[model samples]
Every structure is written in C-alpha cells, then in structure tokens.
Target: MQFSIAFPLAALTLLISTITAQAPGSQCGGIGWPGIMFCNPGSVCSKINDCEGLHGSLADQM
Candidate 1:
C-alpha cells in the first residue's frame, strides 16, 4: 500500500489553525507540531515548544 503525507500535513495545518483559534480560555497546544495553539482575549495558553523531546505521535498530543 502507498500513503500520501500531504493529506496528514494538510489536516494538521488545518487543526493547528482552527483549534488554536479560540474565543476564550481554551486548552490549546500540544499537537506534536510545536508552537501552534493560541489564547483568546483575557485568556492564557501555555505554548510547549519541545514536543519532540517527549517522543510521541500526533494523536498522542491530544
């Protein structure tokens, strides 16, 4: 069987943008991509930039 990375990449990119875009204090970040999530107005979101160190997969992040 053959697999295409483009699809997964695209999905990740989409999730990174959509999920991260929150209106309030939402649990954003930790998608194994590093520096993707964000916080809303008067909210705080901790950004973890060392996902590779934990040695995990994309789903594992969630």
Candidate 2:
C-alpha cells in the first residue's frame, strides 16, 4: 500500500516540475502574472523593463 501511494506521489511531483519549467524566450514572471517562474536547463530568468513593469524572460546560457 505504501509503495502504491509513493509511486503516484513521485509521478505527480515530476509532472508538476515539468509543467513549471519554462523554455528560453518564454515569460517567467511579471507584475500581476501568476505563472511559473523557473526556467528550463541552460536558461536563466532575466528582468525585462517594459512600460507596465519589470517582466521576466528566460535568457539562454551564455
């Protein structure tokens, strides 16, 4: 029983993590934006100044 529960829990965690990973050039954060803020591997969240406010963009690795 414990094994059955643990397997589902682990799968859910992995699914959630993948869902939150943002691709390069994707928006990760900004004022009033309620979404994932983590960038995928080889990318970093960067601030982009716009008229509204500071937004986040996934910058590719240098």
Question: TM-score winner among the candidates?
Answer: 2
Model 1: which residue pairs collide? none
Candidate 1 segments exceeding 4 Å error: 1-3, 22-62
Per-residue alpha-carbon lDDT of candidate 1 for residues 29-60, written as tens digits (9 for 90 to 100): 56554543444334455454634222223343
Q: Model 2 lDDT vs. the true structure?
A: 0.62
TM-score of each: 0.30, 0.47
lDDT of 2 at 9: 100
What value does the lDDT take at residue 55 in candidate 1?
26
Task: Point out where model 2 deviates above 4 Å.
Answer: 1-16, 50-61
The whole-model lDDT of each prediction reads 0.49, 0.62
